[model samples]
Target: MSQIDVATKSPIRQRTQGLRSRIEAFVRTFEWTWTSAVLFSMALLFFLLISAVVMPSFWMYYAEQKIGWAGPTDLQAFLEKPFGTSITNPLSLEGYKQVRDAIAMGLTTG
Candidate 1:
């Protein structure tokens, strides 16, 4: 139609145009240098965030494996039962074997 009518425009098209105009106006306010700096700072912060979480976790898992129960002291701490301590129900060797298997598969050795 040559004449514009409010009812003639599709609701979806109207909403899309409105949102696109808002975004364009927003982008126009910032220069390329400001945008690049903001983006770089965000990227650096994100990398630091991921490493902060991941590095400690990796080290903990690494320590758990490398400092495994070779000696009785390590074994005692891991089992939470001293060698002299007596208990009615002993821990299963199956769990111990599974841990060994996991260590072989590159999981934590402890």
Candidate 2:
């Protein structure tokens, strides 16, 4: 196998650079009007709203399923305790809160 030096660019690198340049040019030439700005904000907000609702619901459902227990039979119950099912799953809000609390406790106690 040959070594790739800084001066020598691979075909993949060249293609990636070309794509990046095209994207940059498009962004530079984009017309940012008030309507466009509002539309963009609305689209972003819509995406956030969808994700905020959907992702948590899925997470809670999956976590409950994985734990082999009947947790949060309804959406409202799940929303009320979003991280309740995450006691065993460390990738959820409860995990984050526990970690934050532990760090704070350590800092204050020391």
Candidate 3:
């Protein structure tokens, strides 16, 4: 019984030592590389998300400052020009129906 216990203990110790060495080698070779890659990707995504939120607001404020007190009128003109030709005429129900049909077609196809 003692001989069997001694024999089993030696093999178990050897197996544990082999596992530890393999794990250490793997850590030494690839641990920091994978960790840094993941961290950098996360930071890049965070930067893009923050910029998406901030950049448009910054542009809007800059545009308003550039336009000064007449900004609202300028915005109305800018919005109106596109709708006049592209979407619908501001004065007509037929134009509104055309715009609605265009939007529905676009949604269904896209």
Of the two candidates 1 and 2, the one with more favorable TM-score, higher being better, is: 2
TM-score, per-candidate, Cα-based: 0.30, 0.49, 0.32
Model 3 residue 73 CA deviation in Å: 7.8
- Per-residue lDDT of model 3, residues 1-110, tens digit only: 58777677877786798799999998888745688999989999887766665555554454445633212223344445534443434423333334444443454343
lDDT of 3 at 40: 89
User: lDDT for every model?
Assistant: 0.57, 0.60, 0.55
Model 1 accuracy (lDDT, Cα): 0.57
Rank candidates, TM-score, best first: 2, 3, 1
Regions of model 2 farther than 4 Å from truth: 1-7, 65-67, 72-110
Model 2 C-alpha lDDT per residue in residues 10-76, reported as the tens digit of each score: 7788679879999999999999999999999999988877666665556445545664443323445
Best by TM-score: 2
For residue 56, give model 3's deviation from the true position in Å.
Answer: 1.0
**Candidate 3 versus the native: TM-score?**
0.32
Looking at model 2, report the run of 10 residues with the lowest lDDT sum. Answer: 67-76
lDDT of 2 at 103: 46
